[model samples]
Target: MSDESNQTEGPIAGISDVPVTLTVSVGRARPTVGELLSLTADDIFTLDKSLDDPVDLYVGDHLVGRGVLEELDEPGSGRLGIRITEIAPIKDLV
Candidate 1:
């Protein structure tokens, strides 16, 4: 077979269009079962991380990246976004 025939059109051609769910872990709270069940409206559940901590980005159980939480500044969008600070190696991701 010719080399051209074996070459892919582009890097990640087959999987580039694949849709994957990316999860952003802002923080975690370890509330007791009683505390969780007894929660009422307007309750403030505290997280283990502070506002300045970097959030973790995960694809399935594997950690893919880390980023800081940000609020989008588009007029009235008010959407929450993440600013990627660190990324796991490609080998680690797969």
Candidate 2:
């Protein structure tokens, strides 16, 4: 086998079949029924993460990367600003 035969593809593109754990934001807890009802006019529920805080990225039970959430102007169209911290090894042979 020649070296050229070992290197042919530029990149491998496909779907990832890995288990991941994502931490979702619950925002502020509702105080009371009256207070919750009163909160209507201009209510802003802030996420748990701060602007400077690095969001934790996990693959199954392992921590692999961190990303920031950026809001999009066109409604719910935000993207995950990912910074890959580690390259996780694919276990189970399939």
Query: How does each model score on TM-score?
Result: 0.78, 0.32
Find the candidate with the highest lDDT and give its number. 1
Worst 10 residues of 2 by lDDT: 10-19
Clashes of 1: 0
Q: For model 2, how does the per-residue alpha-carbon lDDT over 1-94 read when each residue is reduced to its tens digit?
A: 3455554342321333334465533233546688777787788655665676666655454655455555645667674344444443444212
Q: What is candidate 1's lDDT per residue for 1-94, written digit by digit as tens?
A: 3455654454554664468999999899989999988999999989989999999999999999999988898857889999999999776855
C-alpha lDDT of residue 90 in model 1: 73
Enumerate residue pairs that collide in model 1.
Answer: none
